[model samples]
Each structure stands twice: as structure tokens, then as C-alpha cells.
Target: MSTVALVTGATQGLGLALVEGLAQRLEPEDTVYLTGRDLDRVGAAVAAMPAGGAQVRGELLDVADPTAAERLAAQLKSRHGGVDVVFGNAVMRVGPDDDPRRIVRDYVEVNNFGTTRLLRAFAPILRDNARLIIVASSLGTLHHLAPSLHDRFDGPGSLDDLDHQVARWRDAVADGSARSGDWPGFVNIPSKIAQVAAVRILAADRRESDSARGILLAAVCPGMINTPTSALWWNVSDAPTPAQAANGLVDLALGPVDPAHYGELVRGGKVLPWSPASGRATVVPYAATTASS
Candidate 1:
């Protein structure tokens, strides 16, 4: 059987490292696609990777574009028949904002809604037992929210439900009515939370149907990486470099699926346990704001 995998937003940082790691593991006939928004960046990323027997290719795939995913899916379907693994790593993390409201909305559109769009477009093309991993954060753990809001997030909710949650956040941030603990004031936290929620819902649905596909869906929080993006919010002296972090992600992308870990937030190859009292996953830097990979 041939191996086919994809990593989105792979022009730099963790995404780039993932592509390189996958390339090392795959055989010559297998293919690993490194995708990003810019063709130039994508080409550069692909060129930089050492050929580890896999066919490393570059493609332009902006998750924010509603149609781009479908177009790529159709193309890949025609050639490879199905996708064995997919790593969603795109984000719209704002530094400083001109219009706070617009920034929040755009952030949701790119970071939250963008994930849903890829799942919708790719669902039809996933091979049996495929791995679908969204690079999320530890902040997604429900303990971060108030007790009243846990049901909306931890329960079975469709993409529409997720959108409703996103809208609620956008409106609240816009109107300056967002409470501190009720919803994280920082937009990245909520966006990552939405991503984790999406994987949980999807994994549950796959289980309910008993499709026998054995798909593994997870929103993974790769522990804080030593990168420029992380430099802004963290002291990265001990943080793993992007290459080191990619090792875990590549394992998830190609390793055996743990039934207990299905539909859960994962880190370091283990299911991230939720403690309402804690409200975040257990990590050295429990509150990481690093965007993208």
C-alpha cells in the first residue's frame, strides 16, 4: 500500500518541521505534500526538506479559502485515491491590532472556521484508518471556561454549533462584553478550544456510525516550541525546538491509533486529561500562546 499524507500551513516553524520529519519516514513511492498560502514559500519549504525516500511536493493551499480545499481534495483523489494522514496547522494569530473587532472576527474565520472547512472537504477522501490531527493548544482544555459554558463545548455539537460558539465570542469581544474567565480574553485560546471541540465531535460521530474505518481524529497540543512566535510570550530556554516538537506530531501522523485517545486532546502521545479545577492541560508552560504549529 502507498502512503499519502499532507501538512497544511507548512512554510515555516512547526509545520515546516513536520513536513521534513514525514519525508524521512515515508518510502520513495509514498508522497508527503507540504502546503501553504504562497507558492514560493511552499516551494522553498519542499526544497529545504531532505529526501527521505518519499516524494516531497509543494502545493498552494490557504485554509481560509473555502474552495481551495475541495479543489485540492479532488486533485489528490484523482491521483492517490485517498489521503492517509492530514495535519491541520494554519492560523491567523494577530500581533497588534488596528481594529480589535475585525481582528477577532478574522481570527475566528481563519483559525476556527478554517479547521471546520478542511474537515468537511476532506472527510470524503480520507482512507480507512486515516489520521486527522489539528495542531491545537493546551488552552483548549474545558477547565478554562466557566461551569455554565462547559456543556456547549464538551457535548456533541455540529459545525453549526461550533459556529454559534464562535459567533458568541466574536460578538462579545466586539461589544466589549466578554468576561475574563467566561471566555478567554485572548482570541487564540478560544480559537484553539474550538479546534479541540471539533475533533471531539467528529471522533464521536465516527464512533457512533461504526464505519469500521478506524479513523483517528485529534486536536494535538504540541508542547511549547522554541520559535520566534513563542519568543513573544515565553521564556524558551528549555522549550523544545520546532524540529523536536515535530517528532511527536510525525508519530501521531504515522503511529498506531490508541482507542482511548480518539476524539480527545493529545500531547506527547498521551491523551490530555481534563480537570475542571485546572481548566488547562498539564504542561510545564500551561498557558502557551504560540500560534501556527
Candidate 2:
């Protein structure tokens, strides 16, 4: 049977680039699904890809909708039997003037909750040895958070414990006290932190179940990609392009699975130490990490 790969948020930016990159490496009989919240954009993206190789199809998916993932899983099972690779790349960014409570809620809804939901819904539909890549960010490193909060994420916290921690942050936002609490003012970092931790939890669960042995699960940071989203938040133009950033993500999704690569934070094709023995430190720039692809 031919291999199948699925990429979420493939309308544009890094997600779209990942789909194209994967398609380039696929055999003629293989298939790649390009998905996004908007059907129009998804269609356009699929139409734009070069033809005559791996089959490319557009799928409409909204990660924020609680029911969307379940529906997608059913469709995948019916059509493809199971997925060989899945790129969980959909994300949401807060806007200025958005209420603090709404910001925290929205970020968690899409970035954390949506990602977990996709993983859970697809676990049964993922073939053994399947590659699951959660697109994360280096900014989500533990060093960016308060000491106590960082400890919670770095240690042996159950999925329930992680949910409890997120609830506390939501409470702080609702009460207008997030700035004074351990929760960071920016929601993106914490959301990514939750994503990375969730990967570890899910990997452990998969191992215990013994249903998906050899499944490679990892969270990868694309670094500072020069996309519309990054431009909205920063005043930088020297970052890597979306296609360049997608290289590391696509490599992890398509590369050979190794025991050392599972449940780790990969940046620019290199695995980062989650808890450094010395102390917490920030991520280096993309240019300094590895050669562009």
C-alpha cells in the first residue's frame, strides 16, 4: 500500500510548505492531504501544487471546532484505512484589544486543546510506526516561564495535571490578574509549552497501550519564520522564510524514526535538551543552528 500524509493548516505559510515538501518525496501512488479551515483556500493550495506525482487532495478542517477532528478521523479511516504521517500545524494568535480571558481561552482552544483532540481522535487511525509531528516554538521553552510553573512542565505531570495548570491560567486571565501571577502575559508561549508536554504524555500512553509501537511522536520548533503572523508580532525581517522553516518540520515528519527522536523538542533538525543540567537558556537563532534546506 502507498503511504499517506496529512497536514493541517495547509492553506499557506509553513503548513503549506510542509505539504509540498512531503509531496516531492512521495511515490506516485502515495497521497498527501492539504487541509485548512477554509475550503476555498485549501482548494487553491491543492490546485497550485505540481501535478503528476503523489496524489494531492484538499480537506476542510477547523481545529478549533470540537467535532471537526472526530469527523476527519472517520473520513480518513473510511478512505485511507490509516495515516502514515500527520503534521499538527494549525495555530491561533491573539489580537490587540482582545480581552485577557478571551485570549487565553482562544489560544488554549486551538493550540493546546485542538492538538490534543486531533491526537486522541487519530490514535486509533494512525498506523503503527506512524510519524506525528506537532509544530511547536522555541519561545515555549521552560526558561520563559516562572520557576514554579516551569518545574510543573518539566517534571512528571499527568495530562490531568497539565489541564489543571491551564485552568489556573484561565482563572488568572478572567480575574485580570495574569500579569501578577505565574502565568505569562503572552498566551502563545504557554500554549506551545502545553503542546510539547502533551506530546510526552501521549508518547508514554502509546507505549503503555502497545498498540502503536514504533510510532514517532515529537514537537518541533520552526524558529523565527518570516511569515505574516511573525510580522504582526515582531519588527524583524531577517528570519527564515516559511519554506525554510518547514524544512525541519517536514524532515521530522518524513525522516527515519529513531528511539532518541521520540518525545523530544527538535529545532532545526536537532534535538534540544528539555531540562538542561546547568540552567535554563533561550534558543539560538535559526541561521546559527543548521544549514537551510
Candidate 3:
């Protein structure tokens, strides 16, 4: 059977680099699906890839749209039977001036909820030993949150618990109490934290369903890369190139499933400690700001 891989948000940056890296590693009979929100961008990305051994195809996917995700899953099932690897690389950033409620809702919709949607749509069809790589961020580390929040995220919680925790954060942001409640007013970090927590929950669920499949699910931080998105938040002139950062993501997706890496947050190909003890020594509190009516 030919190996099949799917990469989300593959139009450019780390996502595109991951697609190129996966293509180079795949066999001639293998296939890599490059997906993005825009058909033209996806098509252009596919066209730009070197005609390597693997067959590259473009597909339009808007992770925030559940219907789009479901449609893609159905198509993948019909054409490939199952997927061997999935790189959940799509992400959104919130601006300082954006409404707190909108920030939280939009980020959760795409980064956290959208990720779960994909996992749900593909879980049944993922091949045994399939790899699910979530492109997370170090900014989402537990160290940034209060000890109480850390416990809730790292503790043994069901998927429902995770959802409830995220929903509470959303409510806090909407009510203008996020800063006082220790919830980050911005979405980037909190969304990534939720993504990591969700991965842990999903891994446990997957294991209960089939322990022997060796299905590896992990969230990884591709150290600060000079992507357009990063440029919006920070000066990236000194940051690593997208290809350099993508190396770890591609490795985690295609490399052997190190039992240690399962359900862990990896960076620079190393698993960082996720426990409360490993959290940063100082927690920066979010400043209180009134949301515009």
C-alpha cells in the first residue's frame, strides 16, 4: 500500500516546507496532499514543489470550517482508504487591537476546535501506526500560566474537561475578566496551550481504543521561524528559516515513534518537560484592558 500524507496550511512557511520535506522522504508510489484555505495558493504551492518521487496534490481546506474538514476527510477515505500522516499546521494570530472576544473565539475555532474536528473526522480512518503531528508553539508552555491553570491543563482530564476549560477561558475573555482570571487576553499562547492539552486528551482516548496500533500523537513547537505570521508579532531577522524549523516537524511526522515523544511537546527534536514543575519560574500576569463595546 502506498503511504499517504496530509499537510494543512501548506501554502507557505513551515507548512510548505514540511510538504517538501515529506515529499523528499516518501517513496515513488506515495502521495502527499497539500492543503490551504485558498485553491490558488494550494495549487501554486503544489506546482512549486520539485517533481520528486512522491505524487503531490493540492486540496482546498479551511480548518476553521468543519464542513470543509469533513469533506476533505471523506475524499481522503474514498481515494486513499486511510492516511498515514497528518500535519496539523494551520494557525491564526490575534492582533493587539482586535476585540478580546473575537480573538478568543477565532483562535479557538481554528487552533483548538478545528484541530479536534480534524482528529474526529480522521480518527476512524487513520491507518494503524499513523502519525499525527500538531504544530504547536513554545509560547504556549505551561510555565506561562498560573499554577492552578497548569494543574487543570496537565491533570488527567477527559476531552469534555478540556473543552470546558477552553470554554471558560473564552467566557472570561468575552466578559473582560480574562486578565484578572489569569487567562491570557490574547489567543496565540492560550490557543496553543489548549492545542497541547487537547493532544494529551486525544492520545489517551486513542490508546484506549487500540493500544497496539502504536499511533503517535504529539504537539511540537517549531522554534521561532521567519514566517510571515511570525513577522507580524516579532522581528524575525534573527529567527531560523522556515525550512530549518520545519526539519523537526517533518522528522516527528515521519520518524520512528519514540515512546517518549507520544503526547509530548517537542522542540528542536527534544521533548520539553510539560509538568507544572517544568513551568517557568515566573508567571507574567495579563494586564486588565476593557474590551470595546
Candidate 4:
């Protein structure tokens, strides 16, 4: 059987570059599903691949649609039985100057909630030893959220528990008290924070429920890539090209799986300092050390 993989938001930017790199390493008969919201763009992106070993196919997917993730999961399961690799790279970027309400809406609807939908739909269908990679950013630090809410994400919780945290954030936004509630003034920080935290929560669940599967899950920060979307936030002239930033992701998938990086946000082989410690998730010092001090 062929190695099966799926890359969401694969039409352009980091997603496109990941597809390009992963294709180069696959053996003949390897199947890749590169997806995006627009069928035209998806076709063009797949058609424009560098003619690597894998058979590249275009798929139409908008991660934000409530039913889209589950529907796609069912189709893939029926056709391939299961998938070996999954790149959750779909995202919506926002400018800080955008309307406060709109910024909140875009961040929650597309960046944050979209990820949750994918996790729910795909987690069960992952093949043994499969790697589930989420293209998160370096900005996902717990320091951005209030210390009071840190426990909601850091330890022992179901998906429902983590989701309630996001609900509280949305509720705070609705009432104009997000900033007062110790949420970051800028919306992107909390969104990314939640993204990585979700990875940790899901990883823990997988370990507890089905320890034999060897499903490697992680959130990777590709760093500042030189792309139009990245240009919106900072100068991209000196940033690494998308192909360059994608190397880590491709390597993580093709290379050996190191359990240390699993369930953490890794950049350039080092776990981001703020991500929880080995086998535990938390941005702050461990409880025992804090209590003893």
C-alpha cells in the first residue's frame, strides 16, 4: 500500500512549500492530498509541483467550515483506510489595526477554532507511527494569557475542558473585557497559545487511551518565513523563504520520531522554552518547586 498524507491550506506559503519538500522524499505510489478553499488554486498548486516521486492530488477544503473536517476525514478513511501524515497548516492572519471585533472573530473562527475542528475529526484516524504536525507560530506562549487560567490548559483535561477555556476567551471578547481579563492585548498571541496547548492536551489523551498506536503529534513553529502573509506582520526581506522554513517540518515527518518534541512546539530542533516540560504541559515553574520555594 502507498503512504498516504494530507496537507491542508496547501495552495501557497508554508503549506505549499511543505508539499513541495515532502514530495521530493516520497517513494513511487505515495499519495498526497494538497487542499485549499478554492478549487482553481488547489488545481494550480498541484499542477505546479516539481514532479517529485509522489502522486500529488488537489482537494478542496476550508478548515473553518463546521462539517468540512469530518466530511473529509470520512472520505479519506473510506478510500485509504487511514493516513500516515497530516499537516494542519490552514490559518487566517490578521493585522493589529483591524477592528477589535473583527480581529477577535477572524482569530477565533479560522485560526483557533479551525484547528480544534481538525483535531476532533482526524485524531482517531491517524495510522500507527503517523506524525500529526500542526503549523503553529513561535508566538504561542502561555505568558500571554493570565496566570489564573494557566491550569485550564497545562494539565489533566479532556478536549471539553480545553474548549471551555476558548469559550471564556470569546465571552470576554464579546463584552470588551478581554484585555482586562489578562488576555493579551493583541489577539494572535492567545490564538497561537491555544493552538499549541491543544496539541499537548490531545497528545496526553492519546497516550492514556491508546498507548500502543505510536501516533506522534506535535506543533511546529516554522519561524519568520518570507511570505506575503508574514509580510503583513513584519519585514520579510531578511526572513527565510517558505521552502527554507519548511525543511524542519519535512525533516520532522521523514526523520526519526523523537518523543521529546512530541506534543510541544518545536523550532529548529529545540522545544520553545515556554512549552511545558517533558511529559508535562505548563508555561510556569512546576508546582512542587513553586510550593517549596
Candidate 5:
């Protein structure tokens, strides 16, 4: 049977790029589901692909809706019987300019929730050699926010160490920290902690399932591309269009696979060493960090 793949947030940006890449890599026998919040945009994206001669279709999904992932899974199960690969790429964010707390919450809802939801809803349809690809940002890394109180749950180190820190913020809000337009924000450090924690838990769960014998699960950060949100950090440079990033995503999703690449993060077609001890995802150039702050 030909492979079947589903990519959420496929209207534009990285999601759109992934669709294009999948179009080129997947054979006409395979199927790629392009999804987005807007039906028209999803349709446009599907229409825009180079007709991989494969069965490419559009799915209107708004990951913000708690039931969106489940609904999509149901539709896919009925039409395709099973899905071989799933890319959880939709993300939600707040803040006019990618504020840390705002970004944190948004990432929790879409990135975190979307991942868990899809896995639960589609678990039954996943075949033996299936794959699940998660697109994460380097901002979530402990090294990225090194020396700061940012949370990291995949460890003996997590926001649990800074419980008091969150309490302080809550107290600040309660005591009126924002002086009417001073910008009041709540930092639920636990959320970020949980988001990263989910990654390891999910990977382990799939590995334990007999039904997923050779399934590959991974999380990757496509080098900060020039998406609208990223533009806030620095003038996008050496940035490949979403199209280029999608190529890497597709490679990981369906191009080829080796056991070593599983659970690894790749950039520009190479596996990036991501040990927290060495500040894998955390370390970055001064300019990028400065822009984020």
C-alpha cells in the first residue's frame, strides 16, 4: 500500500512549504493531506502544489478548537483507512510581538495540545512503520533561555524548581502589577514544562506499542525561517523560504529513514546534536536571542 501523510497548518508559512516538499517526494500512489484554518487557503495551497501526480487533498482545521484534531482523524479514518505519517505543525500564539509568555501559552495550546490530541485521535490508524514528526522552535530549549528562569520539564530540571517564580507572577497580577496599559501577562511556567515533557512521553509511548513496531517519532526545529513571527526577532537572513524548510521536513517524514535519525533534530538536512548539557537547542547567536527578548 502507498504511504499516507497528514500535515496540519498547511495554508502558508512552514506548513505550506511542507506540502510542497511532500508533493515532490511522495509518489503519485501516495497521499498528502494539506490542512489549514481556512478552507479557501487550504484549497489554494493544494491547488498550488506541482501536482505530484499523487492524491493531494485539503483539510480545513483550526487546531485552536479542542476537537479539531479528532475531527480530522475521523475524516481520514473513513476515507483512507490509515495514516502513515503525521506532522503536528499548527501553532497558536499571543503578544503583538512574540512576547515570551504570550508565545509560551500559544505554543502550549497549538503545538502541545495539537500533538497530544492528534496522537490520541489517530493512534488506532497508525500502521506498523508509521512516523510522527513534530516541528518545535529552539526557543523551548533550556540553553536558549540559559541563565534565566525559563522552564525545562524534560529533566530533573523543570519549572518545578521555580514553582515560587510562578507564584510571584500570580501575586504580581493579583497585586496589580500592570499599571493600566503597562502590559500585564501571566507566565504559567508549568505549561511550558508540560509541553516539552509531552515530547518524551509520547515518543516512549509509541515505542512501547506493538502496533507501532518500526514507527519513527521525532521532533525537529527548522532553523528559524523568515516567517511572520520570526521576523520580529531579526531581519530574516540566509533564510530559506518555507519551501526549503519543508524539504527537510519531507525528508524526515517520507524521504528515507534510519534508526539513528529517530528522536533527533535536523537542520539543513543534517542531524543537530541536541544534548541539553551542551546547550543543544539553547545556544544561538547574540542577534537572534536579543531579538526574541
Candidate 6:
């Protein structure tokens, strides 16, 4: 039996990279579902693939839009009986004046909510040993971004970080230390802490799932991958190619799960430390305000 997988935000960055890698690793009997908002790019991606002998196709899905999730669910139900793997990879970022709050909200909506939508829609079809993976950032790790005194905080702390960052910006603007236009706030350590917390929540959700067995789910740090998404980074050209990151993700997708690896953030295909406790994930300082929204 071939394993079928679905990936969102599939036109570029980590999403597209994973699609390509899956094409190589999975069999022709297997199917890979690729999704994005741009229909043309989706078409182009399908046309450009090297015949993996596997059934590879693309679907247009703007994960942030609730309707799109419904449409996608119907389509999946009609076509593939169910999916063996689902990679909740889509995410969107916004600026100060953007709707629905900060970029973190958008990220959570697409990365977190969008992912859950896919799983819920396909719950009936998910195989006994299916895998569910959510791509998450290191910024969400509380230990790395929150004050050491706040070590006791966990999932809720992640949401609080967003509130804290916004408050900090208000204070900064009032003090004449920051600009007033930075509404809903600036990127700070707290935002990162929240993001990591979101990832942990995702892992926990899968761990408690009774629907699948030997299910492997994790949040990975692709490690400074160079793509159009991060073009502003000065060393983008020097950074590892998206293909490199995709390859690493493929390794993770195919690897066996050790209890120790669950809820872990990986770099260079190995889990890394996020705090002094070791083997924890760390977040790089905020660079793109766009990354935080």
C-alpha cells in the first residue's frame, strides 16, 4: 500500500520543498496533495515535477479563508479516500494595520487552525498509522524568549506573549522610544515564546489522538533556509537553499519517532536545545517585523 500525503502553502518555501522531496521518497501508488492560493503557481508546480510515478497534484487553498478549508475537504473526500500524512504547512504574515491583529494571529490561524481543519475534515479517512506533522518556528519556545522567571508558563503563556508584546509597544510609543504607527505592536521575545507554545500544543494534540497509531508529529526549524519569503535577509543568497531544508524535512518525515523527539524542534536533521536545560529549541531574534506582524 502506498502512503498518501497532503501539504499546504505548497507553491513556495518549505511547503513546495516538502512536496518535491515527497515526490522522490514516496511511491507512484502514493499520492501527494499540494495546496496554495495561486492557481497558476500550483499548476506550474505540478507540471514541473519529475515523474515520481506517484500521483502528484495541486489544489488552490488559502488556508486563512474558512471556506477554502471546506472546499478542500469536499475535494479530498471525493478524490482520495483519505490521507496517510498531512503536513499543516501554510502560514500568512501581516503588518501593523493588518486585520485580525498581528502576524502571529494570522500564523496561528493558518498554521494552527488551518492544520486542524485539514485533520478534522479528513479524520474519517486517516489511516491507522497515518502521520500528522505541523511545521512550527523556534520563536514560539517560551524558554528561549520568555524571562527565566516565567519558566513555569506553558501553552497559555504563548498567547500571553502576544499580549505582552503589544503592551510593550504601547509603552515604547508613550516613552518616545518607538514609533506610534507600530500598532498591535512590534516583534519581541514574547511573540517567539508564543509561537513555540503553539507548536507544543500541536504536538500534544496529536499525542492524545486515538485515531492513529505510531503517528509521528513534530515541529521543525528548517534552519535559515533561503527563499523568496525571507529575501530581505542580507545573507539570503548565502543561506542554505530551500532544497536543502526540504531534504531535511523529508528526513524527519521518514524517520522513526522516539518519545524524546516528540514536541522537539530540529536543526540540521537533529533536535537542538531551546534553553539551558538542553535539547530545547531556540528562536533567533526578531528580524522581519513581517514575521511577527
> For residues 94-205, could you state the per-residue lDDT of candidate 4 as single tens digits?
6535545545665676777788888898887888878888888787866544566666567537666777787777677656665455455556666788889888888877
Which segments of model 4 are wrong by more than 4 Å?
208-211, 275-293
Q: Write the per-residue lDDT of candidate 2 for residues 1-293, one digit (tens) a residue.
A: 88999998888888988998889888889999999999989998999998666889998989989899889989999998999999999987665445556566777778887888887777678887788888888765676666656766666456667767766766776666765555655666677888888888777777644333677888888888887767866764999888877777777777776677678778876777665455754433222321111
Error of 5 at 127 (Å): 1.2
Model 2 Cα displacement at 98 (Å)? 5.3
Q: Highest lDDT: which candidate?
A: 3
Estimated TM-score for each candidate = 0.89, 0.87, 0.90, 0.88, 0.74, 0.72
Give per-residue CA lDDT, model 1, range 117-168, as digits (tens): 8887787788988988899998887656555567666764687787787788
RMSD of each: 4.1, 5.8, 2.6, 6.3, 5.9, 5.8
What tens-digit string does per-residue lDDT give for candidate 3 at 45-69? 9989997668899999999996888
Leading candidate by TM-score = 3
Off by over 4 Å in 6: 93-125, 148-153, 157-195, 205-212, 273-293
TM-score quality measure for candidate 4: 0.88
Q: Each model's C-alpha lDDT?
A: 0.79, 0.77, 0.79, 0.78, 0.62, 0.61
Give the poorly placed runs of model 5, Cα more than 4 Å off. 93-107, 145-152, 155-196, 210-212, 268-275, 278-293
Clashing pairs in 2: none
How should the candidates be ordered by TM-score, best one leading?
A: 3, 1, 4, 2, 5, 6
- Candidate 2 residue-wise lDDT at 249: 76
Candidate 3 vs 4: which has more lDDT: 3
What's the number of clashes in each of the models? 3, 0, 1, 0, 2, 10
lDDT (tens digit, per residue) of candidate 6 on 46-97: 8887876567888888876867877776777677665677776777643344
In model 6, how large is the Cα lDDT of residue 269? Answer: 57
> Which is the better candidate, 1 or 3, if ranked by lDDT?
3
Which prediction has more favorable TM-score, 1 or 4? 1
